[model samples]
Target: MIREQATDKRTLKTIRYDADLIVVGGGLSGVCCAITAARAGTRVVLVQDRPVLGGNSSSEVRLWVLGATSHMGNNNRWAREGGVIDELLLENLYRNPEGNPLILDTILLEKVVMEANISLLLNTAVYEVEKSDEETISGIKAFCSQNSTLYDLVAPLFCDASGDGIVGFQAGAAFRMGAESREEFDEKFAPTAEYGELLGHSLYFYTKDTGRPVRFVPPAYALDDITKIPRYKRFNAQEYGCQLWWIEYGGRLDTVHDTEAIKWELWKVVYGVWNYIKNSGQFPEAETMTLEWVGQIPGKRESRRFEGDYILKQQDVVEQRTHPDAIAFGGWSIDLHPADGIFSEKPGCNQWHSKGIYQIPYRCLYSRNVTNLFLAGRIISASHVAFGSSRVMGTGAHVAQAVGMAAALSARHHLLPRDLTEPARMQTLQQELLKTGQHIPGITLHDDQDIAQTAQLSASSEFILTELPPDGPLLPLTFSAAQMLPLPAGPIPQLTAFVTADRDTTLTVELRKSSKPFNHTPDVTLETKTLSIHKGKQEVDLTFDSHIDEPQYVFITFLKNEHIQLQYSQLRVTGILSVFNKINPAVSNYGKQEPTEDIGVDTFEFWCPERRPAGQNMALRIATGIQLFSPANSLNGIQRPTNQPNAWVSERNDPNPALTLTWPTKQRISRVELSFDSDFDHPLESVIMIHPETVSPFCVDEFVLCNDRQERIFHKTDNHQSRSTIRFAQPVETSSLTIHLKTNHEKAPAALMEVRCYSVS
Candidate 1:
């Protein structure tokens, strides 16, 4: 409410703020967007309409923060998201294992406030937009109802991470609402006819036992009839949290404009459902349970999707397309729901996953119509089908991270959002992201200033890759195609495969080089071998004269024969991966019984029906004469193990083991970052419902950093974090650096992902 001091221009006063970036919304994506830009030295103004942060994942909504790992249930193989969100997840894992939404709200708020470059405005809703033109948003006017203050926020660049694209809509940016027709984007998942109905919103409630008999009296709005509810049979009194993501509504109406109406409907459904559980004759065990918390706000699924230069389609995700300017990656299934939501008689949602992780181009992050505006989170440029996959909070966090880095780069270079899409600039942006521990899946970091690339790398111990660890049950790889695997730079002696043939048959396995490393497509056949196998489970071996001179790729392909089947492991392998036939129809949740390998696990092309012999390699192995473990492997830019377990360890006999990196010339360094082993092989659950007897810990307890002159520049005697960064007060020049470590209390051997040094510019 702005009061005019006087009619004359001389008596007018205004409250205004200027920042490098303005982020609208305090959701997970917006929080990451603002924090990333601010951390990279950009002034940001973060505006959230709610007093509490974390839009959908807040206490008001209470949706779990899901990402590529998919709650550690989807075994997409080493697909956890890193960077700012990773830090939050790791911290939450340590602090709030119970997965309390209130704790998460404090975590998000504290993260935003700790950044000195960010100005946070909670309970402020931006309703007015002042644009320089149709193509640029110059500023915005927001009202903080709590404080009764009017805010004028101006910035060079703006991001609409509000999940509804409100800023982009106000700025007149091109956008689409609801679902598209099948022919629109040639999307198989789209509806046959174009419809205005979109995926609905969800409301959740938490119920806990009071340790004694409790009675619940239905409120006036409580639902009475249980026969109308189709999912009543699926309800369990003990279930809470995101297990109720399907208690949704309001897809038939505008999710944004009719939010209040939708919330009311959701509230009715919630209380009604609870009444059926406690008051209805069907439930007796719920007598001791009482409603603890229920959501006032609904967690939305889809609304207005802003148009970018390129719109991601279902094919892009299913095909796992690798973009030239890929800035992010998503692995969640393409999950879409019916417009009627909970009212729909059919299943609530349908989903389809990719063969492997897919890439998200930078072109899909900024607006095609609004030059100065950027978009992240659920509102990014994607068709409804594509949005189904990228809508998850973890994937949205990745999108926000890219937008933040791009915002920082744009602010520093005096370039617009679209201008940063140039190849060189985009590459630099990717390098910066990787430097900050955001894994881009396919992209490799090449920093010329990194002295480790030219240093004489030596470690006290190295992890030797001699045999494959026990693997999960194998399925038949009988399709008329082949499976692929990558070999280290070493010699290959005899290739082995476990198989059970219906009859005596000859099997041919070809070794080739992969043309595309991301897709793992075999290009040329380097060697071929044919072996005869019997009917029972037996070991089949083929000798090949192939030697990998450099860190190149070697793809393994087994000629398809219906009678001949390749034997694979029954136990799931943690860090190693193999690509199976692409043309074969995907088996949804092939091995759902295994907790570590559940639904969305089949998204990767690594499953085969053939079972491997016990104590044998899962599929194949090499008695490489060449050394697999060396100091050089640590700085090869391959951080997390995807296809193989890679690391350098010290000899067990050595009294003092350390890794020393020495360069030819001294270099100015400002920061040293270390990524230690977090036991990627053993999976951890985000929502722990059942307490386990033991947990695996992978963080180093203590470490010391010394320069070439033996002068201690940084030392941490008490470290329990997976990723650690030591920034010197001022840049220190050094030719060599060494890390002395104290073994973890758990007695697990020391393992690391990467050790990187950076010169702050």
Candidate 2:
């Protein structure tokens, strides 16, 4: 082959891709968004400027993904954001429990490439936006440096998850970058100009032991003096990567345009910090350690927040306000970093948590001015204070999942993003999100198309809250412990707890419940009982004469007694857990929160559950078995636990745990959706943290489905996810359907959250 002479005007190879939706940025938000849209029957083009997907969570940046679960630091029970984010996290745990950032990168790339409807363009930066008329974005121009190719992506719907609202900015969408004043949103927690108007960028690094002395020589660019860093004394060999999240900078500068400068500053800080740890003569243990990896780019926090029809403000999060068009939820605290970042004399971060998770309105997901643009990730319509909570990767992923589903819906109906704000369309949007395992706070799925509603459901054995036998280890009461119970609007039940007391003392048992039904915070005390205990182990009866006005979760609180050792049961059941009043300093929790001033934050106790293998239920016996876990709960259309245990749990030691649904007449069904308990409460942080189990003990690992003739139609094994959608290759006509679930662990009983059957595939 012979090469031709270069022409006067030479251009790069241009590729044109027509899709139903175009997604910018390949962060967790953009990845989840593209995956959701592709799964929902929309042809999508996902454009990511980086070499790999997962922006901050990628190996390049290496920040852990956290959201509603808030590191299990607060009182948000079973509060993990679901949908695509859960799937990604679960998969990461199964494949890379060590949290190898490279594996996670592969997982994100695999998820995108696996979707046949999606065309992924990595290392492709969108430089120009083409408008169809005045308000709508018709197409985008992107160039991939790796391939030296220019791509023209055209789509009817567009989602901007590009951290700094690149697409929205180019499309003339309304946006705000800095903080809003206290008077603007009545947010007393709003940061002043002296403290910080915006959260800054953070860079992370990894360290490893070479098993031998590895000398590190500081580069010319590395800061020679580490004493300049305010918290340089706190650095250690163990506190690398995201553990040193406070190593941030560049809030005063333009985070969008001046990202390079910001990254350089972060690099300088990281290298300087490492140099201090290596050569500062502080620790002999770090002599064998070497810098494994340093972040190439800074993980951005605040930038240009695009405007939507409604801006989510401080009150919406603080007051736990419900929106009519609620599509998702967020539970992370209003966490703001100091403007000075690493050099700041002030604390690294200021955080305030709400008692419960708040709903996110659909109106805040799409641009107000840019008609065809969908706002997502950190750029969604939210005040600076509110953005502090919603900016996390998991929350951003959840929000972008809604945008993806909405994009799919918009494509089908040929309607603009604003048109979905209608009441009927909003309901449909929420219903669709629920079907996809996306949890919307205070919203229950009531799909009219589900034919399983007409069937009569019966289980082999429905679980009754009788007793958690004291068959396991006896643990000391390091903190105030409580057994969370879902009760009806009636007299409180009598409970018995077995405990070994070191010395004779008086035990104070108080019954408390949240002011709200769905909330798990024990803010209101219902009744109290004090019992005299002996030095030896004995059972104490907690008979409280308390009644509630409504059905809710009540905390049978056992006040902290260091001398006492409470018995814990290994028998784990779905939607039932015991919590401890403790401090998780990551979220600013210190036993109990008592703000000195009215900072638009609540003063409450944090009763959070311990991680599995440790968060076993306290052994207790009930006066009467609570008749809450009924077989019909599977048809209640609620997938996750809310005010009560919305799952039908099998009785302990049931030889055959099965649920049967019978219909009067035979019907053809092509699709079936089954939802199980997967410990939705667990945060499943995607980086650094090692989990005890890859699958939740509450998750049903094996299950079988049979038709009227007892013919095994479908069987699933090695199941670890919350939602399982079974599509029949051929339509099956049957008058009845039976589901047999097998327990994954001996501790956990078989549980089913929801079962939906549809005629359409």
Candidate 3:
């Protein structure tokens, strides 16, 4: 084949695309936004500057995705961010439990490519913005270096999720780059100039043992002195990736314009750190290790935050504010870092957590100045203090999922983003999000069209939590431990646990509850009982004269005692966990949390559960049962455990557990949605961490959907998702529907969180 040569001043291949909505950036937030919108039937064009879909979470960056759950360092229980992000995380856990970033890259790419309504452009950076008016972005111009082509993408609406706010910047969207003063929002925790104005960019590296001695050489640009880093002495050959999250820089510089310079500095530091490890003789383990990978780009923590109708401030997070137009939620702690980064003498970060998850209003999602533009990811209209909390990838992705649904609604009604903030429209938006398994605090599903809402529901069996049999291993009380129990609104029951004491040690047990019912912080102590224990194993009576006003989780705490060992049970329930008061340096939780100063942060003891294959329930029994699981709970709208166990759990011995929904007349249903217990409390970090299992033990792995005639409608197996939407080929008319469910693992009892039916999907 012969090709003709172009004349002087020849143009590159230019292409134009049109879509109903255009999303800039292909990070978790943007990718989730595009996927959600596409699922809602909105034509979408996803433009990403990088080659892969996930931004900081990509193989290139190697940062784990975390949000509420806070690495299980906080009190939020069953609080994992859901929807497309949950599906992706679960899939990653199934396919790559080892957390190879490359496998995650493929998962992200596959998700985007599978959507028929999405058009993705990789390695393409937007350079120009075209506006239909002063406030509306009509189109954008981008160039793909790998393809040597230019693209013009136009859409009715635009979403700026490009971590750096590039599109919003070019479109004249109002934004703030630095932290607001303490006086501005009465944010006592706001950083002073001495600390830092903006959070910095972080770099990470991985090391591998080569089985034999390996040699390493530093590049010319490598950092010659690792001592320049104040925390350099803390490094170890065993730790890598996020464990070294403090290797940050560039908060003092222009995070956007000087990104290249910042990257270079990070590269120098990473290489130098590796060089010191290889040749410094401090780490003999490094003799058989080599630098496997180093992040080419830094994971950004802060940038230009675009302004919306409402700027989420510190009070909104601290108070757990309820918004009238609530559409999303966040539970990550307000974490801020010093601008000096790794070189600073101060600690790496300052984090403060809230009592519970807070609602994110729809008003904070769209730009006030840029009418047609929506702000997502970390760039949303959150003040510096609030951004410190809502900036995590899972939170941002969940928020952007709402943005996606909003875009789809806007397109369907031919309206703008602002119009969706109306009372009626906002309720509809919240309902839609809940239907998709999105956990919006204080909101429950209220779909008038869901026929199941009017049907008579019954279950084969309802679990009555009486005891956790002492059938597993015993764990040493190296840390203060607590058994989380869901109790009714009455007198607290007497408890008992099997414990072995090495000596005649005094054991302290405290009955406590959270200041708020939904919170698990155990801030309010009801009673304390000190018992004298002899050396041998014995059943200790933990009878404390305690009473509660409402149904809430009561923490039966056993103080740390090296002389005692507590019994663990193999039995696992949908919403029960045993937590330990210990330190997780990553989140800065050192059991008891207290601010260095009076920074309006609460001081409390952290009671977080350990990752599974470990965190088994304590062997305990209550003479009076906490009858929480009922058939009616399956229709209560709330899908996850909150102040109470809001699920219909069957008895462990029940051979066949099933739910039946009966209608007075034959009903034509197009779709049936089921929400199961997927252990929402577990933080499904997608990279750099190994997950214990692919599917949740509480998930219904096998289920049968049948019509009134007992005719099988759909039989599903190996179901691992939190939400399962079953759509019939055609409308199925039936007077009754029965769902036979089976648990994913024998350790967990069969549980159903919610069941909803719709005439129109």
Candidate 4:
């Protein structure tokens, strides 16, 4: 049974409505438009037919948010032009530790709900546009699924971020569908002739690994031959969970008319594919690896585009044309899939491009025949060939930002989008966008020499270290007292740190290790501490000479709190020696230590390397001491004396604690050395030291070493370890370093012997 929300039809007709701008669609572009407008002080109403936002990227489609360029390519120029998008990226780095769908949904909800100027209505579909004549859209009628009622929303400005350009179409705006002949725009990628078909859609799914025995079962209708599409064969079913298996064509046989059948076929194909994988037993652990989710909606890649005042053509993309009123940018190549149908011709049968992104004029975002309506997202006016490149969600987001800003400016100045296209008005809009962190050509002007000098100086400077408080109330910590380096003419220069800890505790911090200057203090800390390190002379050595009646664990930590503005480059550490009270005569009278409990060797540590330029690589080495034993026999070593009733078994017999390490292997660095203490098994000691090998000194921006994963970014001296060091390849220009430590654990007390930053030459 489909259990939906109970609807009350009569009560919805009388509800009061309010909004200066009504954005119809809750996809990426629509959400960005609504958020941008709302942030600009305009009342915004964002409507979506589905219960969730992020049309293609939501749990519905399960499509990952792919930016213009990424680690995989140089096309991520769009991401560099940050705004609300940049804010979203930073938010995700913290909130979505695992970068999963549930976390992404939380981010979307928070972004929408936290904005006071925006009101979101989910499960509401826009059915009609109430317009004044053929040129002006006055209001819109929305069908609310939750209440089964109809509501009319009146707004001064309407943005059709709907990928289908629904509002523009209903309001009598001129629109185009399918492809244009090659001669129309002189686009090399255009079809030889015009056509009325569109790109297909896709359905996605998510999976996970259980690391256990499993089995697979094929679907009844699964075809062994066609199921193995060569295009998707490289993906390993055992590793990746989400698969784009349900790709199908639409729009040609009546998009609206064939949606139901298309949806059903997509589902059947998806299930069949999964069944084939399971039944084939190509993966023995297939049964243990469960399917976490399946997309609820098909992700539409193409739809009708509303014709705007200025139609963006393939010429604009290939020539890299700059528009006087350019509002957005496109980088993806002019890739056009077959319009006839999926598999009609091999995928990407008709595709061509200019090899780079180009300027897209602002005129292409608003309807040429309509005054009050603006269109963004996939439905922007562009030839089929050009639309192929500009249709990505990231670019759509940029377009939405432009449209939303234009609408806000129009409503505020009592002007239409057409008026804002004037040179002066357009320049004004461009300035606003640049200030808000949106990317615009001819906007980012800086001195190249200064940037280069800063990079050079930063690379040559010695590391600075600072220690933060580890107990009671947590406070903001600062690493460097100097202001943020100016944007250099060349690539962005970075600051790096090597962190180490002596004990374990939770610490909260931010992800961006380097930060810009601030007036007051920012709440977000950039990094956190996790795990521990202990090595020979090059790692860590703590020797405690004091004798005590009861055995105690030692600890050390590094933290990054709100006051610190920094970036992280690398982290390295070595576990060399661990001391316990097992060999002490007095402690031996008590029962053996429990296997789960720390055997007076509860210390944690790690190293933070300096950040370098984008292209430069740094070499680092990490080694550790080992003590191994069988798990079963290890429990036998837990011995108790006659008078000791509270004694527990020892874990020493079960071999040493397990350790797993990971670091960047691409960089080049000198060798790392680690040594262990011979008297670690004795008790009632003062401190032990883990030291590093002597090498030529270098400079670093910051250093943080901590035991706790949460406390890594923030450093406190109260939990200092007996041994730690900040090594650099060359002397740097920075002054002091800030360190954070965790003091939450009662069993382990962290100790710091010394904090130093030295010059190599």
Which candidate wins on TM-score?
Answer: 2
Cα TM-score of candidate 2: 0.99
Q: Encode model 1's per-residue lDDT on 1-761: one tens digit a residue.
A: 97856554562234689999999999989998898999999999999999888888788888777766543333355676777777776666556667777777887888899999999999989999999886889999888877778889999899999988879998999999988887778775674222235888998989989889898888897767766778777777977767887887887898989999999988888998898888876888898999998887889989999899999988878777778888888887777776777777866766565655688888999999999999999999999888988998888987899899999999999999999778888899999888777778778778887766777887777644444422434545455344334456666656556677888877778887643444333445789878777776777666778776655445666777888756554322223335444331222344321224332222233322221122122455445522444566568676665544445554333455578988787877898878765544222334423213122244556788888897888878656455798888998888888887666432234555678787755
- Candidate 2 lDDT over 1-761, as tens digits, reads 98989889988999999999999999999999999999999999999999999999999899999998989999998888899999999989888888788999999989899999999999999999999888989999999999999999999999999999889999999999899989988889888875667778999999999999999998788877887888778888888789889998988888888889999888888888888888888888999999988888889999999899999999999899988999999999999888989998778888889999999999999999889999889899999999999899989999999999999999999999999999999999999999999999888899888999999988999899899989988998878999998888899888889999999987888899998889999999988788899999998888888799898899999998888999989888887889999898888888788878989888999999998778889999998978899988898878888888999999988988999999998989899999989888898988898887888888999999999999999999999889899999988999999999997588788999999999854
lDDT by residue for model 3 (340-449), tens: 88889888988888877888888888988888898889999998999999999999999999999999999999989999988888888889888888888888888888
| Per-prediction TM-score | 0.82, 0.99, 0.97, 0.58
What's model 3's TM-score?
0.97
Candidate 2 overall Cα lDDT vs. reference?
Answer: 0.91
Error in Å for residue 213 of model 4: 5.8
Which has the greatest lDDT? 2
Task: Report how far residue 550 has shifted in candidate 2, in Å.
Answer: 1.3
**Given candidate 3, what's the lDDT at residue 205?**
95
Model 4: per-residue lDDT, tens digit, 684-723?
0100111121110111112343222323322223211112
Query: lDDT score of model 3?
Result: 0.90
List the global CA lDDT of all models.
Answer: 0.72, 0.91, 0.90, 0.49
Candidate 3: 10-residue stretch with minimal lDDT: 193-202
